[model samples]
Structure formats: structure tokens, C-alpha cells
Target: MELITSNTHQNQIIEEDHVIKKANGNFIEANTLKVTLEHLKNECIIPVFSKDNESTISHYEFVLKTKEIVQDLFPEFSVSEPDIRTSHIIKGRIPSAIGKPAKELKEHEKTLYYERCAFVMEIPEVVENVNGNKLALTIGGVRAYNQENLFSKKSPEKFKVFIGFKNMVCTNLCISTDGLADQIRVNSLNQLSEAVEKLLGQYDRNKHLGMMEKMSRHEFTQSQFAHFIGKLRMYQFMDKTEQKQCFPISINDSQINTVVKNYYHDPNFSCSGDGSINMWRLYNLFTEANKSSYIDNNFERNVNAYDLTNNLVYSLQNQSSNWFLHN
Candidate 1:
């Protein structure tokens, strides 16, 4: 698995040209917030009005403002409206915050845990045929509750930029997890534009597609594919060892197995006889698996599942020959 770092690492790689520097010079926090709120209204996620004993106020939160800035950079993609259709309810709890079920606390002592919320913006994809197979650059992102939140006065929300592939014909989301950290991250709004540019660079380079192209040239027998599945299952529940601990995320065995099953058995994954052993087919299988596990309002669950699956795929892709041979 690739070492994941915060988004700031990207600025070091690409030189800050005059355009970005000039934009930064022109950045006015108050004006930016105003512009961002207008964009949120465009997407129909209105700001909430709150009246408390101390004061009465109406304002947009950090999450909504962050969304507006992101949309401004990528005008081509449409923001999924922030309604039930786009929302996810994350499960689980911090044991320390809320004690075991057997214990009960006073009403005022109850903890406040809001459901995890996320938004995904669909990027336009560029598809190409490689050795009679399809390859694409699929891009999207996730902003959520736990990683970064509204409580912090200076830094209120967490935003992640992601890249994946979408099979043109079948429309399955093909995700390659190689260098996962360098591809996604948490960032401050000041670095938002630069971060978006870096992600766009990945899409332009066809980073994931290049890997798939090489894999497509190789062949995998049925037994080898099964062995790959076995490895993923193992990773699904493996303890967090030193080298393998990059992103702090986990997915259970049942969820992992379900995604693997759908990859091979689902009609969307069906390929021509010649397509059976190619890498694109394998990539599609796993990406398909990740997409199939979505549970409404289960934001954190889906995010963890996607991260774990991506890590497994990244590990497998990094040592394809060794893994394929051992199996």
C-alpha cells in the first residue's frame, strides 16, 4: 500500500507558477465565503438558521463553502444534491463517548453523534480501448463528518480528492488503489485549487489506466484469480502491522467477500471469452464490488469498505507477478 499523506505534500511536487501565486494574492476570505455560499444555493443545500439563548444567527457551515470552491474548479461535473439520495448515515460509535448498552446515563449526559454525511461530484471520463479492452479515468471525491468537522474554528471540514475508472459500456466504477495516499487527502481551503489541479494531473496522465494496460497484456488462470480473492480476504481482517498501516480504515470479511463475489458473478462483469484473463476485467471486478456495497446513510461504512478494498487492490497490483506465481 502507498503511504498516504495530507494534501499539502502535493504542493511540493508541482512548482507554484505565477497564476497560482497571483490567485493566492487575490484570495479574500470574506469574499470567498460569500461566493461559496452562492454556489451552495445553486446546488440546493441551504444554510441552517440557529437561535440559541446566547444569540440568534444565520450562516453557512464550512462543509457547504468547501463544496462551492470545489465545484468552481471543476465546472464540468455536477454536484449530487445534498438530500437523502446523496446523504449517508454512518454506523458505529466511539465506545468512550457512549458507554456499553448495559449502562444508562442522565438525559443531559447523552453524547451528541450526528450521522456521517458525504458528497460526491462526478468527473467527466476519457475512455480509450486498449488491446480490445476498455480503460478510463474516473474521478470523484468525498467530504465527511469524522475526519474534519464544523467544531474547529479555523479548519472546519475535511475534503478528499479521488480518482477511479468507469467502464464505458457497463458503467462499473473501476478503481485502482496504487499510490492511494498521493491521490486522495485532507486539505485547508487555501490549498484547494492547487490540490484540484494535482488530481487533474493524475487523470491526464492516465496513471491507473497505464497500470491496467500492463495487466491486460498478462493472463491469469481461474485458480490465480481465486488466489487473488483469498489474499483480499486475508487483508480484509489482517491486524494493522507497521508497514501496512497508512490510512486508518477497516472493512469486515463479509463485506469484502460480497464485493469479490459480485465481481465474478454479476452480469455487469461478464466479459468475452478472450476478456476473462485480462487485467481490465480484474480491475472492473473489484471496482464493481466496491460500488455494490453501498448502504443508504451508511457513509462511514461505505468509506471504510472502499478504502480497505483499494488498499488490497494496491497491494495486489504492486506485486502482480509474485502474487500470480505464488497462487
Candidate 2:
């Protein structure tokens, strides 16, 4: 068995850049959040309301949308998913620069957790790009370029700018889903509980997404080693080391790449949980006052996600073996 390096560490390598810089004179807290590594459980959900409209929450379905979050991880990455059909639930699917009519999801025997995450935020108008024309920019499903996707979730609204990280680009499609966070709006506790149930259901559905990423890293690296290729087929690494020391087996790694790849690369695959931070609680910084960005705190990595780093993680980046960049 190959040794597993924790994703907690890989996540650390993926740091949230935070330097207090001025955007529009108001000095938006343009940095990572203050959550500690210990506080960030794989499924830890933190909910935040808009700064201008405290009564309403910003549509964060964009988080799980691969294109929405991919640049944060790899600024060079670009999303190619084009067809993402519109859900009649909203108006027709949002239009884009691509040709051909919208497309339907190419179902896999196995679905993904990000799909559920995408669904949670898809059901909102903000994710629908309501202010694109006013901004003279495209935003939402294909080209989400509106303030709601940016500024802190609160009342009256706060303005901020997020300059693109690298040579990355985005195209929006009018995608929407049923508000899984609508739990906050329920008049009765019972109805609210139903909303909570929907969020939990999505969370629980793909309990192994974390493990899958680790596994993919391993299998992908080993594929080139013809000698070991035969033994390198199983694609998932997850476990509980100190079972008695603390929490139970909370989740696993499974199909996370599928989720991200689909939402970021496959347009026909549009839905609620498209891989961007699929849940409302995932964006807890909204409640953070005194100025703080999301992912401010240091996060810890699980041990099972790093074995491949020993061999492939850095070398084969940009889809090729660039010797100058690696060793």
C-alpha cells in the first residue's frame, strides 16, 4: 500500500493570500479569513448574510462552480464546460459567448458532491447575474461579473474588487437552483428544518469526495510507472487514524475532481452543486466583522493526501513535464 499524505497539507500549500490593500478607498478587508486549521473541518459549513442586506444571503453557488473557484487554486486553469442548460425553475439558462444551444448533463454511473454544492447556490438570483448589464460585464453561470458574487453578504451592500489571479478567464451562463439556505427564511421551525435537511443531504451524499482527490493524485502519478500501473488502479485514500482519540469517520475522498472538472470544464453539466462552495455555510466570512477575508486561518491537512507529492504533484504541472519549474 502506498503511504497517504494528508490533503490538509495540500490545502496549506494552497494558501489564501492576505495583505490589507485598498480597493475603492473604503479599504475592503481583502484577505483570507481568520478560521484556524482546527476549526475547518472538511464539511464545516459557515453561513453569512450580505453586508448591505443582512436579511438576505449572497448566492454562493458560484463557489462550487469550477470556474468560480479554480483560479483561486490554479490561476492558469480555464473552464470549457459550455452547454449547461438553463433550469426553467429560473428563466431560461443564462446565455454565453459559446455557440450551439444549451446542453444537458452527461450522466455518469457515479455523480459528484460538488454537483450538490452547485445546486445549493444555483437557486439564487444573484448567481443568475441580475446586474451584469449595469456593470457592463458578464457574470453568473457563464460569465458571473456582478457585485453580489463579490462584496460581503450584508445589507445596503459593500463594494470590493477581486482582480483575476493569473492568465485565467471566465464566461457566465444563467444558472440557478432552489435555495437550500432558504432555511433561514422559514417562518416555522419545521420548514426551516426541511431546508437544513436539503443542505445536509447534499453534504452526506458524497461523504468520500475528500478521499477521492487524494486517490486521483496517487493513481495519476503512478500511471506513468508501467511496472506499478497494474497495482495502482484503486482511486481513493481515506481513514481514521485515532478513531478513539476524537471524532468518528466524518467523510472520505471521492469524485471531487469529477465534481470540479465537470463544473469548471463541462458546460452541459450545469446544476446547483457545480463544485463552487456548494453550500451557504461554506462562506462564513460574511458574519466576520472588524474586517477579515475568507480562509484567513491556517488549516491542517490529513495525512492520506500527500504520498503522490513525493513523486508527481509539482513536476507534471501545466499538463506537461516542465523540468525547469520542478527540480
Candidate 3:
């Protein structure tokens, strides 16, 4: 039987005060706006994914669809070709079938496979010059063998789209929630352009720049940095009310300390003139650990890393009002 796919093409405008329109017919928005990645997910992404459908879209197919949607909506931005990254979670030391292609290995022989495929498109040069930074949009899908749901017979994949900013001088990747773009799962055939424009229109470039500047200016002393680390560690087990949980597994203080030390030791992080540490550096520290810290099949590790990163960002945003209020 042949598979059938639906075409979802639609457009609508959203009135946003923070959106800035350039002379060249391009617009830029800030990440600090009320409309955030989470809000976008709840508003558009979740509904699309929840639609009733007989067939499910594969990760590869979703990437292609997203790429097409993006290119069609914004013709000016330079979009990158789609790329797939696969990691072999289970491999045997001895070769079972030497003649067969490595890519054709069976699931039982391989045991588990992990994949994170993405398409990165560059933001226009004009926008970059205006913002004083280089930026890119990443639309990607992730699927690990253990994360798959076969028994439930549901879609066994996930999708996301976000923006990344690179510092012009320091060259550090400041990964923030792609507030300008929607980070959502490819669940159904739905209108993409309207959802994208609505989110983009909410971006206030000036507000985002101001927030970034604030993060850069605030410097943490040695004692302050240590306190930050303590807060980060505590946040892992505590709830929003600062109530601690009794987990089955013991909390590893040494591992947390090692992760914290690794961030400051890294030379790429931004530092104040007085040699104090910046929030951007601290933020990257969590992001890097989240992405590369775990080699084993501990899915919970990634979840915890994600949560930690969110907590860190929230703390930085309201450092003056109430630091660690969410913990």
C-alpha cells in the first residue's frame, strides 16, 4: 500500500508590538517577549500533533517537510541543506557480516541507535549587522532506540525548531529558546507559515538585545559563582516550592561539582574586565553538559540537563526579583 500525506499551506498575521520591521522588508524579534517556545508549543504545536491521522510521519520525512515550509515562507534567509547525525549505541567488537554495508546492519545486531538530524539556516546579514551578532535557525528531530514507543503504536519520534546566536567577538554559541521560531513536534499536516509568522512577529529585537546585554554585564565573584553552582545542584531535586525530593538514587555531589568546574575552566566563556563570570558563560555550561555529558543510555540524564538549563535561564532573568524562586 502506498502512503498518503496531506498538504498544509496557510498564512495569517498576528499583531505584535515588539516586532521590528526593517527597510528591506525583513523583521527581527527579541527572545525575551511573552510569547515563548513553551507558549508556541501549547498554542499551535500541540494541536497539530494531536490531530487524528492513520499514518505517522518519519523523522526524515518531517525534516524535509519543515525545510520546504521554511524556504517557502521566508525566501530571503539562506537555508542550509538537511543533515542527519546518527550514533551507534550498540555495536559488537567482532564483525558479524563483513560483506554487508554498515548502514544496513539489523536492529538486533546493533541493539540501539540514536539520531539527531537538523537543518541550520543562517539569518540574513542585514539582520546580523543590526543585532551585532551572527544567528542561525535550527529545525531538527531526535529519536533514540529506548525512547521509541512501539507498544502504544504511536509516533515514535520528536521534532523541534529553534534559533542559535553566536557571539561576534568571543565565538561562543549562546543557545537560547528560539523565541522567534516555533519549536514543536511534527505531529500532523498543519499550516506552518501562519504559526511561524505569528511567533516571529512577537519578537522584540531591542528587548532581546537588552536582556543579552544585561546577562553580559552581570559578573559573579568567586563566592557568587560558587553560590550559583550550589543553587544549580539543589535545583535538580527540589520542586518549585523549594521542597526537596527523596529519590531512589543518591544525588552525586562530586559529579555536579565537576560539571560546574568544567564550565569556568573552559577558555571560551565570557569574563568581565574585573575577571568576574558572566551569565552567558554559565548558561552555556549547562547547555554543553546537557548535550555532551552523558555517553551511557541514561535518558533521565538528558531530561535533568534540560530542566537544569531552564532553571538557570529563569534564575538569571529574575536575579534581582527572586533568585532561585523556582527551585
Candidate 4:
């Protein structure tokens, strides 16, 4: 489906503030530090393959190239400054004619490069309001040292790209399998660009949004909510044979605890005074808790949240025998 035309003048007014708010809220308690695009390009060191002179694609290059592609495809969309995360730092000291031990090298002589990076950019103009919460189109990718073999010849580098919605209120990503390219192996920038373009071109935005809208129509009573929590907690300990019969959930016990806490305490998504919660709010609770995940695991878990919640909503509407929903 074609993107809905946005109000340019009004979007410009709130764009900066919106970017700042999202940057501040995202990545709390996570294994990453936020950085600006300029900082990433100018301050970070580019890494080279250990066995060859060839350099791997830098994080800045990946993000910049993707941004260029997005701008070309959707010129009217206002892209936010990148929300960046870098970890697993590799440090070194410059070689000197007078050989010295590593401990003797001055701090100023030390150079560093991050071994992993993940980032997301939001298209604020491409937004949808579901039950009073705003979700904007977001695109991002991840690069990790573990995904590559630096000692080998110039092999296909690994990357992951995802297109989804970022909850404007909490900066929680909402993704599904349709929106994620989990294993993108490419040899060059051109190949990477093509991969990203194909993913965006094929995504069904209308169908995804329609599913989210349907979630608002399904509610969980206090009793049902309690049962769901108990069943989910038990599912983690269930045997593989038993788990295969039920809808899959990727979140861990800590995240489930967060969901139960938010069901009663979240300012915007909490259950109503009647002690009932809708699927949409419950879905957000799961996504919200996912912010604590490591950068490598975050997007995958976000997609799982959408899949799990979507199935729950289906069970609620069709009276299916989902283990979490049925008695």
C-alpha cells in the first residue's frame, strides 16, 4: 500500500523534539550506548580484517547508505536522527619504532572500535494512531563481529534489517516476521541496498496495521488476565513436547514479570478501573519490557511479541484452544 500523505508544516514543528524524546527513552538498561550519526562517522574507528587489508563495512557507512536509500524511496517522509548502539569495544595502540609493552602505552595512544552496532531511524510522517497511541514507521539494522569471520577472505558479511513501528510514547518497537530480514548476507554496498529496498517494497503495511487495530477489540477480564500470567509462567518450564502444542512465546520470566507489573501500573496502557485489559495494551507491555534486551536480541524479541499477541487476539475472537487463553 502507498504511504499516506503527511502534513509537512506540522511534522517539521515537532520533529526535533520527537527525535530527542525517542533517543532519551530507548536503550535504557540495555547493553548499548546512544550516539549521533556524526559521532559514529567521525569518532569511531573502522575495523580491518585480521588476515587481509580489506576493511569491513563500517557502522556509519551502513547507516548512512540505508538513510540515503530511504530518502530516495520516500522523499516526503521525515527521517529521524539515528538511534545508535555500540558495544564489545576492541582497543589497540599504534605501533611505534621504539617497541614498548602494552601497559607502557599512554592512554592517548590507544585506539578503539566497537565490534557490534545496531541502530534505528524513524519516519515520523508515516504514523498511525491505534487506540490513542502513535506508532511511526521505523527501519534499522544490526552488525556484529560474531556474524563475521575476519580471518577468512572477503566473504559475505552478515547483517539484519527490520521495518516496523516505534511506539511514539515509549520508543518500543513493534515488529513481525514480515518486517524482519534476520539474515542478510551481502558482499557490497549495492547488494545491501538492494536487500533493504526489497524488504521495504514487499512489506504489507495495511495488513499489519489492520491486525493491530483488531487487537483493541479483544479484551481480557481480571480472571482471564490472571490465568494468562499463570499459564505463561508455567509454559517456560513445560517440556519441549508440551510446548510444541501451544503458541510460542519468546519472552523470558523477567519480561513476563514486567508485563504483569505494567498491567496494573503503566500510565497509558494499564488496565481500566473495571480490571480489564485489551490486547493492544497487553502487546505494548511486552514490547516495553523488550527494551531491556541486548541489541542483538532486541528486534527478534519484538517480532516475537507481535506474533504472540496477534495469536492471542486470534484465539480470543475465534474461541480457539490456545493454551494461554483456554481454561
Task: Report how far off residue 68 is in candidate 3 (Å).
Answer: 2.0
Can you tell me which runs of candidate 2 are displaced by over 4 Å?
1-54, 60-238, 242-327
- Which candidate, 3 or 4, has the higher lDDT? 4
Residue pairs clashing in model 1 are 88-297, 89-297, 89-298, 138-164
- Listed per candidate, the RMSD to the true structure in angstroms reads 14.5, 21.1, 15.7, 7.2
Compose the digit string of candidate 2's lDDT tens values, residues 1-327.
232222222221111242122233211132322222222223233233445433322223222332344233334534322112111121122233234333552322212111111111121111211111110111112111232232464423221111111100122111112211221333233343344444333432122223223222322212132222122222222234534332221112222323233333332221123222211111111111111211111000111112222224333322444221222
Residues 1-327 of candidate 3: C-alpha lDDT, one tens digit per residue: 111111110111111332232232111111111122232223221111234333444334455555666677567776665443334323442257556677877754432212322233444342442123343333333333344343454553443444434333222233333342323443454643344444455545455444554443334554556665676567566674554432222225555664566555644443333445555445444433433322222123323443444444445444532243222
Reference-based lDDT, residue 5, model 4: 19
Every candidate's lDDT: 0.40, 0.23, 0.40, 0.79
Give the per-residue Cα lDDT of candidate 2 at 152: 61
**C-alpha lDDT of residue 45 in model 4:** 77
Best candidate (score: lDDT): 4
The 10 consecutive residues of candidate 2 with the worst lDDT sum are: 160-169
Assess the local accuracy of residue 275 in candidate 1 as a C-alpha lDDT between 0 and 100.
Answer: 27
Name the candidate, 2 or 4, with the larger TM-score value: 4
By TM-score, the candidates rank as 4, 3, 1, 2
Q: Cα lDDT of model 1 overall?
A: 0.40
Name the better of 1 and 4 by TM-score.
Answer: 4
TM-score of every model?
A: 0.51, 0.18, 0.53, 0.87
Q: Best by TM-score, which number? A: 4
